[model samples]
Target: MTEQRPTLADVARVAGVSRAAASRAINGTYGASEAVRRRVREVAAELGFEPHAVARALATGRGSAGRRERIEILIVDPDPEAMSAKPFYGRVLNGAMRALGDQDIALEVRRVSALPVDDTDPPFGRVLINVPGAAGAAYARRGRTVALGRSAPGVAFVAPDNDDGGRQAAVHLVATGRRRVGAVFGPATPCANERKAGFLRVMSGAGRAVASADGDFTRARAYMATRELLEREPDLDAVFASCDVTAMGVLRALRETGRRVADDVAVVGFDGSALAEAADLSSVYMPVEDEAESAIRCLLDPARPAPARLPTRLAVRGSS
Candidate 1:
């Protein structure tokens, strides 16, 4: 087992002092004398018990008067390197860095996948980068972390108006008078579920029926599922693919089945990735950089009031 926790007794015994003395020294309380504090520091160093600087700083009010600097933009993605490589990743980072760049604060992108938190020093302050599932756990290590996602309360994470984006897609299909609508959805991501539910809501609201709905979060998986959906509804008039990658799959499948995009089966995608732009796919777009900025604000001023949802917009193109 790889554990990083340090016991108070370990620090006290090594210092040749009592636990009360060691605690007072670390806590910067009046309980310990100057000599006791000195011995406690020496023992802590020898035993490798890193002072919980963040926790200590809060209790002691040390360095609290300085400007709020260095916003920790923790990236919770499983693949840290790949996240750095992503075009959307760069855009979001640039957004965050640019915002803090003016304020002289740094944007710290930490991957929960690569370097796990050092419980040894426990962060002084934490702000969610994005993708709450991982950030939630990673920051939980520090104990004063905010969530930066849709519906993450008492913390900071931008919620994309996925439901509204979905409604826009459904309205596009309905306005075109497409009776048999089809869809390709990703698996249970917060953003994904919001977009899916939005589509269903709009369709149901308009008294239209969904010909087919498939759950897959990957490009390949969505491609296969879209192919099956097309087969299930040869007369399928419109389709909503949750993410841009998944939308690309849906478009490919529709073409393979001899359905013309917009002409035969209209299409729309979510997140607005590179493939969506390169292929010129019409889409409902969410500003990831704006989301990043919101995270920074929450970290800097907890009372700054986070957005309930980052506003979403639709970009109409050849697809829909």
Candidate 2:
């Protein structure tokens, strides 16, 4: 005979808490203290208790005969090839899937060239990426929306500490005795700007001047920008690429100009992606997967506040 699966009642009884309290704790709703919530969750885990989706929906007053809860990931990138080409998108999807493990929620991904997303059918929740904070905030009016980076007060967000990552890079370069520094700067987005600001702050304090060129977070643009920066600063001994993809372009330019990496010209990149690992490049490692997971958790339970910002650290490799 098959043993019956553990139920919420079993969890509540074992935890020495009321069933109502157990439900609130499991659902991340109000009325449950932190200690109670933790204890209930631990008890539930021990018993292998899994909540029934239909029951949960009925309890929350969101259930219908044939309807299941759905969450959408809205990406605001003009490029049609972003989903396949960008590693960041893949990482985000992986994290979201991890957070939604064994749940009955439906996941949908949609890419729009620009926003105000005009979808008439709003999902139960939404995750916004590559959208401005003010623009992303507008979606909160329609449904529960979580932004991937810093957003306006009305919207919740999960962001990396971009400023701190940049500061770390600057210190690393300076400590290595690099004086003539050049930079490939990302486009004027909030996260990119914060990184630039932090890097500049440390550079100014160290009495170093940075020669910079603009990059649009693309390999082609970064390649052209690297060439342009090299032309303007021929004696540059080190460079900081805004991201790992951009670092590939910087490496190519250096090779073409007969500059030895790490020996003659040190190079540092961001994102700590597979590209960086394969190339043995130094980079700032941000918890992209964790950020995505946190965003999904916020969507699952509106009561939970989205994490303000995740942490970042420098990973020193052969390129630097």
Model 2's number of clashes is: 0
Q: What digit string (tens of lDDT, one per residue) describes model 2 on residues 80-120?
A: 77777567888999999999887777889988888853668
- Tens digits of lDDT, candidate 1, 296-316: 555544445667787888888
In terms of lDDT, model 2 sits at 0.86
lDDT of 1 at 161: 90
Please give each candidate's TM-score: 0.68, 0.80
Clashing pairs in 2: none
The positional error of residue 160 in candidate 2, measured at the CA in angstroms, is 1.0
Taking every candidate in turn, the Cα RMSD to the unseen true structure, in Å, is: 11.6, 7.1
